[model samples]
Target: MTYSLQTKSIQCPYCGEQIEVIVDCSVNNQEYVEDCSVCCKPIIFSVASFQGEVVSIEAHTEDE
Candidate 1:
């Protein structure tokens, strides 16, 4: 499988800061974690993609 990287801007659920995230477009649907750039808190990511394109994305805090 090819690794396709897609960049997305999302608001941090914790600090409400806009952050850029790199998504793996090769995956159809994926859930992952990443730290916030501003707050350094763990972020939960829900990503949806199809055929190397991102359909939708959602960001949440660790508890949410």
Candidate 2:
């Protein structure tokens, strides 16, 4: 079996700057924290996927 991930562009929740991120399609659900490239703020990443496809993605601030 072969798994292929996806690259997506999203705006930072703090600075509103667009950034590119890789999404793992193998994971049905994923949550991680990453720093915003522009603002350097912690961004809580929430991803949901189904059938090796991304269904939804959300970026939130650390305090939210």
Candidate 2: tens digits of C-alpha lDDT, residues 1-64: 6685998899998998999889888889999998887888899999999998899999998889
- Model 2 TM-score is 0.87
Would you list the C-alpha lDDT of every candidate in the order shown? 0.93, 0.90
Model 2: residues >4 Å from true position, as ranges? none
Q: Best candidate, lDDT-wise?
A: 1
- The collision pairs in model 2 are none
Provide the RMSD of all predictions against the true structure, rounded to 1 decimal: 0.8, 1.4
Alpha-carbon TM-score of each model against the true structure:
0.94, 0.87
TM-score of candidate 1 on Cα atoms, chains taken together: 0.94
Q: Count the backbone clashes (under 3 Å) in each candidate.
A: 0, 0
Which candidate tops TM-score?
1
Candidate 2 positional error at 39, Å: 1.9
